[model samples]
Target: MPQANWFPRFRLFLLGVLCVVPSSSLFAQEQPGQFVLTPGVVVDRSANRIFVVEPSDALATVALQSNTGEVLWKNESATRPLSISAGHSLMSLGSVDANRLGVLVLDGDTGKVRAESPLNIPPEAATLAAPLGEGRLDATAVIRGQRGLLRWNYTPPVTKQGLPPGTLSGLPNAELIPEVAQPQPALNDNPGGFVEIDLETGEQSVVDPAAAPNFAPANDAPEQPLLPEIPGPKYLSADGRHVMARERTKGESHRFMMLVFDKQSGEAIGKFPSNVSYVPFYVDEGRIVLQKEEFAEAIDGQLVKQPRQLQALDLNSGEVIWRQPIAEMKFRGPPPP
Candidate 1:
């Protein structure tokens, strides 16, 4: 909960690059390695640290233990994912042009770019994506127009593909996955198809959910595509079957909508009341974190000092486990759950 101003600021005067430039060209003075300031929407946490990407397109990789903030990275243009996922590794995505795009993969141990690639994966708009777990960690990216999913296995001896240039493909006996159906763009939309890749035979199954009795459609309501202004750092459960996200409405009101989806079944679990950001969603454990707030007139003629609180929610039972006021914290923003 550190103030935005508390972080480091790069002084442009130190760089002689601006000396030859005229004053009129200066719409905004650039920091040595920073982007224009904006409120952050995506937050990624791994181990003990949290990385917050500001809306201003600046990157702040913070050490949660020390409560100390540092400019681990930055961007020059106004971008979408101010901060992407920073865990055992960090993934960052940005636009290079209308059709062209780029991705920056950073080593989690040391904030350094391990790879940079152009927008080769289909047209789907995806943020930072990294493979989780051990053994042949792969990168999965959503393919926009094709209504499909694209994954690249990057466990070395990288292969080259026609479209996604650097993507390894058609290996003799490697764990490679070519494509998958894009999950329906509706709330709680269940995964309609399945792909089973065998390590020995390299066989795949495009099983339709409709044919399988074990599977069920996601939600009872109509499908809704994710809104334009959703906060990222989308949380995937330990199995990567569920995703927790915040959908926002732009403008003065800044309304926010909380959504939980099961990627396996393509189902909408539940939408909570009020806007909440720091929620922890674990589907298998039947646990979710939520928050609520209210404003009232103060007893003294001053504004009410407290309006925010947090709670633990049980998704299956649909009940509240606990509630606590967020007033005692020394920070200025919402307290962590």
Candidate 2:
């Protein structure tokens, strides 16, 4: 009977090996360089790359890398200069006299410029914000306007919309896009394709600004004054659902809050304290991973601080789930004890 059971065990083991062999082969066959930008910037995987508008007001630089941390490509323009939002797309003011910002779209995979549109805005615009949706080239531009916000749909010939007031601040022209009105999400991976909670329809679609675009001379709503007690907004959620901010307390240390908001309506959902400073936080699924800093006592008078723990927060429940510690082995040994 034992010998008979051995044969059955051998058959089961052989079957397991056969299944493992294919998976191992597939894993070995796949190129390790296929994945790009590990962990990715912005919670939005779509905006895997990042570009910085240089402080010198000169040219902009793209930060492109494979998922394996390999530098894929970079673009630097000295003539026109560039200001990219968050992803492959960039904004370039053609000239000081030009009254518009040229929205330049680029392929995320290949870093190729595909299209350009002149966003109707004054050259003196302070900053440019980018969102991801659709393809690498096809994206929405959320232009920071003097009065309000201007949204431009780059693919469909730069459809313009303006948000006066009471709409979302940064994403002013979001309402002009029809996809934002729909129940399902419209803008996918394009520059500005994120759905917000549409309060009127009670559905998720593209995020709307504080006020809808006043295309005609209609009775624009009164501008709402800034709230006195409202805490200052410090961070914008990549998906446009929440804002991580800090409020100064009378005598206490700085109060940190993870402000959950309705992306569509720009209404406050809830705010929870994270109780940390200058820490990098990420919204994974619905949880917030606050990468906290840890310090080791200055023993040999060297400036080497070690990271200690990752504070994880449950955004929905507003609770600290766990504090994952950084393994001591990850850090080099100090000069002495």
Candidate 3:
């Protein structure tokens, strides 16, 4: 008699348990309002808050809520909230008003407007990219109508160490560590170069894509074979240290994999099986959170139970820290008439 393949079967059984388990303690928190969380939502784990852009009709509101779903503050204006990014004690909002492009900086703790500026880009430009590192407020926007990139800088409130005071104040043990310079990332390898503008000086320059630094491995390091090219959307970590993408397995259309790579060297770090469909929510503190859905047939032919799951994965080890059914966290629109 052949030995049974117990390990594979056990793995599948464990996955099923993770998907069906309803006793997870993480879901005990109160549920927030029926705000539809769009793709541009931003999470600040250090401040224990989540910022979401809620659009109604002509105007949009940006609301900040605690991790447990308590509404902190809501800022509403004439422009629609395009994108939001937070760092240190400040948060920047990229917005669009009719044909005008605007950027607003707010105090992260109080949601008060600290500075407001306008970008000199085409009105049709819709995409916005903002800074992610601490005390950084540089932003970029893609001009779809003119095929150009718009970039601008903002001077964030800094302390003696050159970092935002809120960042150091929030630390539990701030006095124990010495001040140091932030790590500078090599020029990104993305093919799209951008135009840089100094908000303070009103100067602009075009950056050539070819001049970007190449991240190839050093000659002294052992040669590492490149990973097979994977076709899927790519998501880069906020700090530019890691990249993650969804890839389909060869010869198996149904099997999907999540591959993580080192952004500096372009080397594959780890890969793991993943749900065929999932939404990447946020990446912070070396972990990535994703929302996945699983459907089950119901006895009533017209009704199907779709369970939403929240999963946290450690970026370095590709290990699942926790998997919980979070149906309450799923976005809910207004009730049917």
Candidate 4:
């Protein structure tokens, strides 16, 4: 994967602009003759390349470019590329054609297909997770009435000395988590049970809701509207031992709270108050970067306001090491009507 620092920071900015600014103003600043990026674009900064899928009249175009905006290669064979994953100096492209799902693993530096895997699933089935780790591919797919977990062990091509290239080295091990199904009526409203599959041994085990960590009793206030549930935690420790959960307070204040819990024991360890919702931007080496949008100022004709703050929190202490306000640009658009 591209350097963790640049990838997350760039994604944060992209998400903020998309959420706050209108589409018209977003493209207004593009220079003439520049290639307009579409919806599916993935950047591999560590490999100094950007993968883009360009929609067209027929099949979408897939192209790879250097960090300096130079085209390295273009692939017109694949259909719409849904998502991309990178690891061990390789990039995997998830694509679809008709009723078949395909994965094309590419050389991160050369944009060449090193391996390809095709799967057949119902058209309605969607990929729940596809993370690459330790020269292996772990994925989950969910259909309307079914779900499955899959693991693929990848063996990269090697040289005569039996050593992989520099780009294929230092890959981290994969961490796989199964999706918890809705609570069964027999389980008494506790939806914490999930299936765990051993990718290596092909064994399956069930984790009971009562035994799962971070399992909290449901809020029983009938009059209060339940906030929209986020799919996962706001942050997880590097070792996956701890998770930070976000909850919205009831009543008119509409405030939020962050609580840390043991991943296995489901025990609350620490709690803190927060003004805005946040997402983990970077997590490594005992530090975490949380990105949040405080507020947006709408200029009548200018782009929407950008995020105003960033904070670094220590994983061990759950304390803010530093907080800083992002500098705003001087140029302003017309005031909102």
Candidate 5:
């Protein structure tokens, strides 16, 4: 179970930034200052609201206020959420002006910025994004009109070969993200293909990554919003009725304590400590939303995690109804979420 290319793209020492682990490697008994997981909670429960993106280098989102979660709107410019079609709710990667390259489609549900639409791709290619610090992981199946692909994952710029940017890429993206080779000059400015968007007139095209398309039968239809790079121990709300699960109250412990299950009666409604980045919202049958990250302590000896809060629970008194608080995100890129 240890083969996401052997996972070790370490980051999160509370931004003290330090990762060693080289006893000869093989995970060297794990712990390269671990703790780097951000998608940071996203539970829109058909407008019950509670999104807290917080990528801390750029992403800083927060749109609470649905049943008094308070604080509706901070900054929005979503980073690849694609698949809330027709009414298109989150699809990032914008700009159909300033030089072509598009994809903005944001509705963000009355938190402001209603509709963006832009992603025409083609301004000399090469510049997919998410490289030069970190914060990226996209996978789409978008459908409303016709063709839809979107695979964009940058991650390549080992400081111009000085290493220290997740360092150990063979990129198959975990085999597909595990093809590590090109580290000699940004390799065509860091690219990875398949951005076929046309989910109805937004139009754009580009494919190579070996022709990529099959979209797993349209991202396993359950009413497609197609987003899976790793989204859940089981979440599904936004009108699918209810289905949250992100368990780990202690099992792979590294200072973990996170729960949110009700995967159809497994119980354990909500209890956030943090670690869940996309979808975990039920709101309505009584409430439940998740996203919080705070490991705080152990700096040099290692155990650094950060991403303050954004909580909501009460699926029948699970308690912790409102928490919101996440600050410290740089690299600038705010305008849609």
Candidate 6:
């Protein structure tokens, strides 16, 4: 049997982690020499806005104009975005900070705080608050917000208890018992349990955080003869007329690639390999923005793989509007550590 993939790798297995693509009015992915975007990016098509969360330290949330890539607002009130809500006008997130602890909502257009609710969990709740190693990106916290409800992960304070006297404690040679070593867990691997809280009420409950959220839209689209094969998490476009997801392929070290299909016609519009990690992606106005691998040198084996490049590809015209390295991209907040 295949062992289960964990958080990130595990979430990538969700197969339903879909995003909607715009069917009309495409725009430039980003203004050259402007903002840099990472995974967990969200696009609000209705408002013509783009949202990005700094994955590393300084966990700030930023809003940019989708067309011009202009900075609208950036703040730390929301750490990790769970999903876009209330018709793409609002974004829900897991909020954790020095004094505040709870669920946070932001205005999609302006990065302004629309509402804040206290979570029964700690500000350090969830792996999002967990310290990231030198280079880690998977946020295992079971963060999800919908219909005024929120779910996130938090580490509980460890309690100490003495073991009860073993029946064999007095057995002969019991004093010679061996001390078995306890296995140490890898950081950023476990997601732990999620604390489900009602945004309207202070009510809270713990939910299983072992698995990723299945946001895969209904597979109502008739299967087309050449529909792009989606072997991983599938993202459905906003209009529910298109679908996008990753498929494994050969010819590259990263076996997984991206594919988009017309849900109605079953025709493949786009298919290619990219930053294959289970990073968040968004499709809007006939354009898809994703992380593209870059290279410092072509013949010298200088590929910028550590922090890849963000690229926008027009699905309608098959044109690449913009592309930039993430580490070199400009922003208004503290440097991404």
The top-ranked prediction according to TM-score is 6
For 185-253, candidate 6 gives per-residue lDDT tens digits of 334433333455443343556655454343222232223233435454566543345666666667775
Please give the distance, in angstroms, between residue 243's alpha carbon in candidate 5 and its true position after superposition. Answer: 36
lDDT, model 3: 0.40
If scored against the real structure, what TM-score would every candidate get? Answer: 0.27, 0.28, 0.35, 0.27, 0.26, 0.50
Best-to-worst order by TM-score is: 6, 3, 2, 4, 1, 5
User: Candidate 3: deviation at residue 75, Å?
Assistant: 1.5
Each model's lDDT comes to 0.33, 0.33, 0.40, 0.35, 0.41, 0.45
Tens-place lDDT per residue, model 1, 13-33, is: 001100111111122222111
* Residue 258, model 2, lDDT: 51
Candidates 2 and 5 compared by lDDT, better number: 5
Against the true structure, candidate 3 reaches a TM-score of 0.35
Name the candidate, 3 or 6, with the larger lDDT value: 6
lDDT (10s digit) by residue, model 3, range 37-62: 22233445556655543323323334
Better of 1 and 6 by lDDT: 6
Clashes of 3: 0
lDDT of 4 at 242: 54
Cα misplacement distance, residue 302 of candidate 5 (Å): 29
- Can you write out model 5's per-residue Cα lDDT over 1-337, one digit (the tens) per residue? 2212112121121121111111111112122211111223334444555444444644334556657777666554453233333242544443234333345554556534343445432222223222223323233333333444555443332322344665556544454444434444434454445666654455566677665634332121133232333245454553343454344556643433444444445555544444433433444556654444453545678876644665567766566766666543222232232
Error of 5 at 317 (Å): 27
Give the 10-residue window scoring lowest on summed lDDT in candidate 2.
15-24
RMSD of each: 22.8, 25.9, 25.9, 23.7, 20.5, 12.1
